[model samples]
Target: MANRLKRTSEGFISYRFAAIVIAALFFASLAGWIAQELVPPDFVERKAFYGESWRPGLARAVDLLRLHDPFHSLWYRFVLAFFFAVLVACNVSRFRRIALRSLRAELPAGAEELRKRPLSFDLSWRSLAAGPRGDADPLVRYGELHGRREAVDPAALEGFFARVSALLKRRGLRVVSDRADGVIRFTASSGRLRSPGTMLLHAGIVVITIGGLIGSLFGWRGMVYLKAGETAPLPPDSAAVLRVDEFRIVTGHGGAIRSYVSTVTILGTRGETLAAGSIEVNRPLGYKGVNIHQSSYTMGEGEFARASVSYRLRGETGRRTVELRGTASAVLGDGAAVVTALRFLPDFRMGPEGAFSASPFPANPALEVEVSAAGGAQRGWLFLRHPDFNARFAAGIDLALDGVEPVYYTGLELSSNPGAPVLMAGFAAATIGLIFMYFCNPRVIRGIATREGLIAAGVESRWKASFELEFAGIREAIRREFDESG
Candidate 1:
């Protein structure tokens, strides 16, 4: 039973089955590529796969399949896994066969097969005496001219063939010779290792697929917002904490935002500092396996630090500006009135339940102040937009809201892809395999000895046009040697 199961596994992993699997994978990848191109980059965060934007049924299907994150989808991973398995099986099966073929000293071919090759040509005594002629030369030159030429020198022809053998050897070709009944046969081949170039190419792809599998299984990406002077814990799997030391924005001459920078500090699990640096729009910080990029920033008054206000009295000659925060009180005129800042709100609004703050944004800013003087004490809100709001208070003193400083928070995008190294190695290997397959092309040339002369045939279909030129050169060389032998 175990043997049967093993045989079944091997059968399923055979080249025929593997080709089918590879074709299916190609279509699957094509479908995934098309689907991904239609979706926005942040489809998951923006919740784009829902509601009226997308039809209900299509949205449900996309959501169920996690099509937004196509790279990590179950079907994508399964296809990669299957393709990798097929590549491994195919390489294993072909490797031994290729190795054995390369080891053979001679490869016999049928006469019909040799004649069918495009590079095949029959040479006879009369043809050899006619000198070298290009295939495009006029056919009248081959008529029965029967011109008298010096008898061929056997020693020079032997020397020429020996020279040809040496040239093929210099070019890394294995030359094999066989002689029978006064007929000499020869075969020359180069780039034997490249005989399995196809298998190597597929093996490189398998490595790349394995890399993708690693990334899909172990990689992660997300974005986090950190206010100035705030520390946010990293993901549970990550053993570091990210602190936003400062968020600075550089403005141009016209107050246009030129650039934004975030000073970040990385801390270990026990609060020990590990690394600290600044990250800008195009620049990112790397700590351990996590990459932190300054993605965006928000302006708000969540942690109000200070507020400025103008203070004056009924008989005051000049107005004085007071900076209020944390128990700062100002006396109006001759201490007749007092004003204290209880708290600061960058954006102050009334909630549904009459609460003070409606949101964290500083869209509508207001300051809550306490006033006490002479006969009564009153409390009210001072708004940035309303300058004359202090006139409503008749407590013998007036206060005007000037401006409030807002806190800026920086958003960081964090990503950890553990498979990046494997992917890079796979890419390098794939490039090498491609160079071997195409650049160092392997070719086979077979020569069968006949009573009249030598019949040469070459396997040149892989690169027909290029091989045609190469065959022309070889033919010229043979003709030069044989003609010189005369």
Candidate 2:
């Protein structure tokens, strides 16, 4: 009675309300996560800080809604927490009833109930009476007792019951028997472990939810760029430091970068080594709860030890290379002309304000050169791509620009999340549960023996087709035994 009441309550919670709530929470969380991605935290902060007049009101609304960081938002977290509770409650209620019923040692239904089962059949001694000649045939019973075979011969009943019991065991059924008042009952079951499979599955979902919560609340991700041999402290408030031992880039046949490799060292605040390893694209290094990945690189202005430019006169036989540095003057080979290196830009760009480098990549190298000779001092832009900036110097000499050397810096992306292990365990548990639920189907069979004959059958498993085939084979074996006994 207690189990029945538990089932009734479980059905009410599971079907009437639990599923809908969980589904709603799941879709809500999903939508919030997508919205968070659309409104990036960095972009929102940039717009808000600059007070950009063109900013979309929707972006501000998203920030106000905390959709910029949805997973960590109060409402989303509450949804996860509530869904977790629902799963636990549903699992506990359903597991108790299913476990008790599946592990039952006795058959709960009577012969009439068994006859009404979907995958059940009957075997009657009256059928044996209708032989080839329609003659009264000798009856048989599989029995370990004599009292129940009052109308039929005891020996015949014993033989039939014995054969059937052995057959049930051979079919991998764990059998239990009871006898009283000239009647015998037998119950058998298969794949008993399946009862707990679904419970474990639910537990897995709860674990995964907890993991996600942990990650949302505590995990962090950031990028750090460092030059080779440079040691930099980790994020503010972190007691660790990262040292770049080396950085390398491998190029493929087409000069495309095939991989980015960084040999990095992790150290304590006191400069003691904690860990050292190499990281490549897709291959991250883990130390002290943090993962470092090779993300990108840059070449910034003034990163080079020296800057230089080469030039050739309009009718000169060879090009002259003159090394350049900050505010340096170099006299031309010709006594009539002079060149002054006023400024250098690794990646040159011109703006209304002034000259500057657009980025670290030295795509268009440039030098600000001032030439003074017998005529007067003239300033011009000498570009590596367009070298003929001041071709018509006062001294009738032309100058062509050359390349500028660059220094590179490596970018490493670091992330830390405390919930990874819990998430992994949850996924494993869920997979095991599914395997048990689908492959380890539970099957139960029951039988009653009388002086007249024996009636035995069972229900098909969830895999209905396979269960039907196995049941058919069991029936065939029973027929063979009956025919042979006759």
Q: Give the worst 10-residue stretch by lDDT in candidate 1.
A: 143-152
| Model 1, CA-based lDDT | 0.72
TM-score of each: 0.63, 0.72
- Candidate 2 RMSD to the real structure: 6.1
Give the alpha-carbon lDDT of every model. Answer: 0.72, 0.73
Residue-wise lDDT of candidate 1 within 1-486, one digit each (tens)?
A: 999999987887776787788798888888888889986667677675354587767766777777777767888879877777777877777778777776775544545677777788755544554566522335423432333223334554454457667766765668898765455568888766565565567777877877876887899889888887788777646677899988888998899788889998988889899999999989999887888888887655435557787877777768888777645787766777778776556557667774265655666777778888877878777888866554356775678888777667788999888888888888887777787777766677887654445567877336777778877777766676555334
Candidate 1 lDDT at 143 equals 38
Tens digits of lDDT, candidate 2, 92-202: 768778788666776635678777777776665444333332123333333212323324666666666787889889989887887765666788778876766777788
| Best candidate according to TM-score | 2
In model 2, pairs of residues that clash are 141-156, 141-157, 141-160, 142-157, 142-160, 142-161, 143-157, 143-158
* RMSD vs true structure, all candidates: 6.9, 6.1
